[model samples]
Target: MTRPKISQMEAYMIETLRASGVTNEAIIQAAKEKDVSTWKQINDQYDFEQLLVLAEQDFSTFEEIINDGYAVKFVTVGGLERLLKLKFQKVEGKDFQKLKTGVQGLDLSGSSLDELKQMLSINWKITKNNEYVSVLLKEKKDFA
Candidate 1:
């Protein structure tokens, strides 16, 4: 069967839900319901209002990131570029000078949340904003 054609925004929302630990079965059931109960589930588990705001902000930004053409990799607000910067922050003993000229990027999809936080080097909290970022970081298959 053919897959349903979803907009970038819809995909973003689905991914965000997945990252926030919403099971695919639950999401599918919610979509089937297509009613207030679906929303209630989200509101019960998270700050739904805040999630909407972050999703709106990330919608267009996510499009731009996809167009950069690094394959189907996901990232937060800063996107792939930001992810790359964080991944390479460690200058270490190998080829710092070569890295200065140019560096091959690693596949960031494999990074765990803890690893991502370490790369970001901030007092990372699991906020709505972070949840949206996690959306981009998650594989599309997660929603499928």
Candidate 2:
């Protein structure tokens, strides 16, 4: 019922990755490029180094941490209805059984509203439905 924040959207993406069965180390790596909501107030985080702090105390694995990371994507501004599009990548490990995770998401966290707008090209639009609204920000890869 509350408005969204950057932290909220981040929390949501983390959850999606986990639901996809991503690993802990991979999630931590993703967190370094992204962020998540913490226990302090509604918007405090432990920074990249502290991602595993919770795991240190509890019996957690790379898998377990990701499992706890699912949610609806929300941002700190423009309310919680606006959804941003992002890219995800999976870096495979040496063995076929294991995989390394990498993040390829885009956000304008430190930028101003104008900067955010300038970042948008003419390749995207916004569409809304009764249940949700989303931003389809995209760039044309090639005119060819």
Error of 1 at 143 (Å): 30
Clashes of each: 0, 9
For model 2, residues 65-130, the per-residue Cα lDDT tens digits are 354322233233222222232212212221111212111222223233233333223333333354
| TM of each candidate vs. truth | 0.30, 0.25
Worst 10 residues of 2 by lDDT: 94-103
RMSD of 1: 14.9
**lDDT agreement with native, every candidate:** 0.36, 0.35
Task: Name model 2 segments beyond 4 Å from true.
Answer: 1-46, 72-75, 78-144
**CA lDDT of 53 in candidate 1?**
43
How high is the lDDT of residue 111 in model 1? 47
| Model number with the top lDDT | 1
Candidate 1 structure quality by residue, lDDT tens digits, 1-144: 112232333434444565556765555444334332455554364443443443355544433322221122222343323333333342323312112322222222334433444333121222223222321232356445
Model 2 clash number: 9
